[model samples]
Target: MKKLLFTSLLLVSSTEAFAKDITVTLEVPSMDCATCPITVEKALERVKGVKEVDVTFENKLAVVIFDDEVTSPDALTKATENAGFPSRIKS
Candidate 1:
């Protein structure tokens, strides 16, 4: 019984550690036109581990959900930057 309990706890802990997801909003002030949002979304999607991307052109904000274990907020920002739309985390 003790062995089974220990194994179960280890499995649960490892699963939790491996499945971390993070969401962040970034302010993109450089988007000049309506089509910029599509460009921004494609850039972010190319980044590894990026699960979802939503860009609001009027608000000039990007909301992204990614796997924390595979990517960071910095990487997300860099992706946008590489696409010619530099951004920063929204306060």
Candidate 2:
């Protein structure tokens, strides 16, 4: 019984250590036209750990899903800036 309890506790802790997916919405004021969204999406996708990118041209927003362990929000913002579309976290 003690062995089984220990195994379960280890499993739970191990799972918690694993990376988690996080979604961040960024506002890109520079997204002025239809083509701008495409560029922003491509930029975000290039970042490491980025799992998905959805850019809404009409709303000038980019929603990115990425692994927290491999990347961060700063990296996401830098990627967009490098692509000529500076962005910030949506309030």
Predicted structure with the largest TM-score when compared to the true one: 1
Cα deviation at 27, candidate 1, in Å, is 0.4
True lDDT of residue 40, candidate 1 = 98
Angstrom error at residue 29, model 1:
0.4
Candidate 1 stretches with Cα past 4 Å from truth are 1-13
Q: What is the number of backbone collisions in each predicted candidate, taken in the order shown?
A: 0, 0
Query: How does candidate 1 fare on TM-score?
Result: 0.83
Query: TM-scores of the models, in the given order?
Result: 0.83, 0.82
lDDT of candidate 2 over 27-91, digit per residue (tens): 99998888999889999999989999999998899999999999999999999999999999998
lDDT of 1 at 71: 95
Query: For this target, which candidate reaches the highest lDDT against the unseen true structure?
Result: 1
Q: Residue 16, candidate 1: how far off, in angstroms?
A: 3.6
Candidate 1 C-alpha lDDT tens digits along 43-90: 999999999999999999999999998899999999999999999999
